[model samples]
Target: MPDFITLTGARENNLKNVDLRIPKGRLTVFTGVSGSGKSSLVFDTIAVESQRQLNETYPSFVRNRLPRFERPHIESLTDLSPAVVVDQRPVGGHARSTVGTMTDIQAVLRVLFSRYGTPSAGPATAYSFNDPSGMCPECDGLGRTVRPDWDRILDPARSLAGGAVRFPPFAAGTWHGQTYTNTTRLDVHKPVGAFTAEERAFLLRGRGARVRVGNTGGSRDIDYEGLADRFERLYLKRDLSALSRRTRDLVREFLTDDVCPVCRGARLNAAALATRVCGLSLADCARMQVTDLIAVLRRIDDPVAAPVARAAVDGLERIEAIGLGYLSLDRETATLSGGEGQRLKTVRHLGSSLSGLTYVFDEPSAGLHPRDVGRLGELLLRLRDRGNTVLVVEHDPDLIALADHVVDMGPGAGAGGGHVVFEGTPGALAASGTLTGRCLRRRATVKRRVRRATGGLWVKGASLHNLREVTVEFPTGVLTAVTGVAGSGKSTLTGELTAAHPDAVIVDQSAIAVSGRSTPATHLGVMDAVRRLFARSTGTSPALFSFNSAGACGGCEGRGVIVTDLAFMDPVTTVCPDCAGRRFQDEVLRLTVRGASIADVLDMGPEQALDFFGDLDVPEDAVLRPLRALRDVGLTHLALGRPLSTLSGGERQRIKLATRLHRTGAVYVLDEPTTGLHLADVGALLALLDRLVDAGNTVVVVEHHLDVVRHADWVIDLGPGGGRDGGEVIFEGTPRQMLTVQGSATAEHLRRTTV
Candidate 1:
């Protein structure tokens, strides 16, 4: 077996024909600026090749069912092992997925309960909530049921013609609205408030009544379902996760969640719930934190339950060993922060008996406070000790210090970066004058002159989650940093602040759920103006300039590629032969504004597009305003037509921030705006936050980066510990004052970073 994994002629993304060899069974940390090809090299190149090769080893039929990965542009990769990529992507499963289930610990617990309970269930399956036999009859194991409010969904005061249905899907002129407006059963012009009982029944709960739709020549008779029935079929029964953000937001307005009345939020059925061990039901056991659950499992000494309980305890102890003892088995995996989720994922792998395999982590220290970062480093070393190669792409200096080998990959970002600048131990790299080296020892001083609060919002008796019943005031018109260890209730306190002040603009890491076709131009609402300008110039309708409309290429429609599905094999996607992937018809391509076609404009980056549009005879604010926002947020390098789905989490957050920058006198709540950012990019982010504060807006950032915390005019530190040990306000003052305070996790770490 080769001692190293080697890559030759790797040119994926901005990588400039790079060639390198990495030692096997060693901890290697890849460092670089954001967009400097770190991901392109680590994920798109190495991981893709490893997984693709492994997929090829399986039968064609099996490969077809597996996820399809696009082959990286690298020429050759040697000595690669099967790679397991644990990304920061939310462990998204249905609402039924919990921490225990995701980690497979719950399965062991189920077996233990089924075997040794006083009143036994039939089998392990019978104790599983995911199984139909164990699922709650009312909520179907979801633990909560969504109740749609009719009053919120309807406006009885308004007539059908006046848009009585308040929901977006059933609004006026929509197809669902037309179902009632064209019906002959009731008066379409009449207000619903004046309807008789029969009329109301016909309008809201009509049972397959025939309704006429469209003109007589093109008309068809359709079965008329009432709004309630249609809504249940259209929205309520569908998977909310798969829907667009806009549609999800619309659906959320009329829906409220309540605990299951039948099983009382215990996802298991009555039979499963009736089975108990040590007088505690399965639901009760799940509610206990992992630390407490360990004690409960230790008491169950029945021979049949012993082995099963041992496995459960082992997994639970592994999770607790990683500083996650505060998390409960019943906690939804979706609610866990990126840092917590990543740690939980690491705990899953710690039990793996396999050796000589490669483990890849993307920013394992992300969302972790400086204190917990040391624990993360220990976990990485543990993986290395298990005889696995641990490859991490990280920005945190603490993790970098633990690296057995360090590979630095840039002097800048984007086009200017990708060359391997240094390759050595962390100590040597620190001494070497690289950007990462300098930033490692750099210290940001506390503000000398703290900005006074214009006003304050008081959070009184706030006791959500791990947070104690605490009252605190968030000063307005200043940049405030909320620092805490993982699970220290920083999110809870800031969340309450946002809830109390609903008018504040929240820019969190929640996905920018636009359609796949949605681009920066479309999202910023600038495409309309561009289309109008082209239409006016060419003496055609504005629709002629839109690929989604009349001017689309007839062969591939608006999409640039033709996707061909090959059963039992990976699908093939080829460029559209008709338009050569331009996504526009010949006639539309012939028309141009300032000798540039619509396709040409879409290809331009934000900065380039702004310059091009400025030279043209177009409205200044119409094009420049939105383009400037992108530039202001350091997204000038992004192309106008780049898909939002392809952007990084940091990019998405910045784009969201760009949209809200113009709002004055509004508070801004940002949750880890530094995520996915390079150390160099953080300075730009701090400047952006300064602009917000200078604009007379209160800015509160929930961050773990020492740079962000030290730069803040005011600092609010939460936690003397995490979980049950955390949630109190340990320190609240300027960063300088915070350092002088004792026993604060944030202060302890801050003291180390400062000169």
Candidate 2:
């Protein structure tokens, strides 16, 4: 019989016509250094094909309404099963999406409340805050009402022609700016700062008036609304994420995200709240941390509430296992970090009884501390033992240790990496000579002298949810680590501190650039220097050196794609056959810079690009500094032209760090910078932290990597436990001091390092 999932001659992207057989009901890990085509094989080749084929099973009319997916280039397949990819992608960006809704716990609560309690509501529907009958009358279902900011719109100083509006989407020369100035009743040249009482009130109040924009020899009438009011209608009421970045920033400058006043964050209507079970509303249960809810569930012995409470407890236990007990069910799904999102998704699959199915996971241990990693491992193994085949693309040692089989892909990333170098049991793979094997078999000792702090920042009376009058001091001009298990109030404390100091540099793992054209070179500001070098070396105008300018290949129009979104068919992103993915005209490629073309320079890895800059006669600037910093952070394997889409989430975080290196006298915050890194790369990243502190900037890092924690001069360890049992800083000291703390998970792990 064929293997449960057989991959034969699988010549997908970067793959070398591979062939493999995987068992149907065991844990198998895809291990390698990052960018080793693990994702290309799992997500691109297998998951996409399964989902695309599943979509095809639907009627053509129905399939047309769904997301389009292109079949990957592969030769053969057998014994394929339907796949459910629970990835690190945020659950939903819709303002309504919350943990209660995503997990369906709120629906269960609605049922429980409708059947039981004091002042009983009508039906289950009547108990749903999301329903109009249950929604708060004031805030509607959204629970939050956005009011316009008058100061952002009505400038009282400069006139309309002087660009006093000062907003991104409504600049002076733009269509919206012209419309406001051309209003017949309003004086165009009047300094907005000097506006009369009526003019100020009318302009700020969003009074709609018919106004002429630029004349076509005749007035073209359009509705003139206040910029503040127009902005609210356009972006504030809707999901700002759907809009482009430029538009989002313009609205963000004036809008403040606030809790809904009517629902008071209950996110439900008053009528629904009238129904209660055991003197507790559904929203009250949801607001409790997972750990706290579990306690509540255990105490409820009522026969009427028993079954529902048991199910809720089971779901909450799954969350705690995935290391998310600190999160409330009411927390918005969109607010979760990628690691948190990934783990939260795993909870849905944890209780599944389906056997003989292949469950694929991407980096299950990503945001987890070493203490939590063991739990993640247990969950993965539990899935495998439940008679399902578990395939995980991971770098975490704890997760890898639980694998029944390990397939190590690599020798490199991108064009250089593809073939599986080793495939065997964990012991055999660890004994092998591959880079992953070598790194796993070895370990690093903490430095004897971790950097020292010259000063510190003190936090007082800081109580932001669960943080219970917490006071802490963060070392200045050194690398201080906030070591904690998940949901240990790290984010709340750090956020409060950052908010207090507006100048603090925050380098989060948010997307660097999403458009296909945005590559590492462009995002890092290296493109301009590269263009100037090409211009000077080739004796041509700088515009001619830019692929986005005169050098654009006409056949592809510099996009390198002929994207045709067929109404119901898959959107095809085929390479520009005319330009052969070069993105520049053939004539442009012929114009060499020194010895290589502009594309060749872009093709160089960050390490190689550093040397090129050193060799060039270009002016020394902040550009080269960050590029070198990126290389030092172990991104040397990455090419400058590699699309942002192709980058791993960890690489994106490092890129964010590279961007913030220019900031001086500013406190820098890094959240899990070592995530998705190989053991070898972790050492390099740790060294980069030292360099950061030596430069006179304060670095505050939230991390689960023990190696990072071991090297920290001052470690603020949160959690005697996670969730309700956590939020208090249980230990604070140097790494040396933490080693003797008996109850601390971080301390125990550091002790093992000494051995």
All candidates: CA RMSD (Å) = 2.9, 3.0
Please give the lDDT score at residue 416 for candidate 2. Answer: 74
What's the alpha carbon RMSD for model 2? 3.0
lDDT of 2 by residue, 1-755 (tens): 34567787776767888787777777888977667788888888888888887788898799888988887877876677778787777666576778877777777767667765568778778766677888777777666766655467546578877867777567677777776666676676889878787876666554658877774475577777876666667777677788887777777776666778878877777767756666778778888888888887777677887787788788888887777888898788878888888887888888778876668898878878788888888888898788777889898877777888888888876667788899888888889999889988886565568666788788877778767688888889888888777777787788877877778888766666577788877888888877888888888888876778899889888877677787777777788997788888888899996678887887889778878778677655645876876777667877888778778776777777777675567788887888777776687787877777777789998888888887787899887776666678889888788878988777787787653
Regions of candidate 1 where Cα sits further than 4 Å from its true position: 154-165, 171-173, 178-209, 215-217, 514-516, 537-541, 550-564, 572-597, 615-621
lDDT of 1 by residue, 349-401 (tens): 99988888888999988888787788788988988898888899998888899
Q: What do the candidate models score in CA lDDT, each in turn?
A: 0.85, 0.78
Per-prediction count of colliding residue pairs?
0, 10
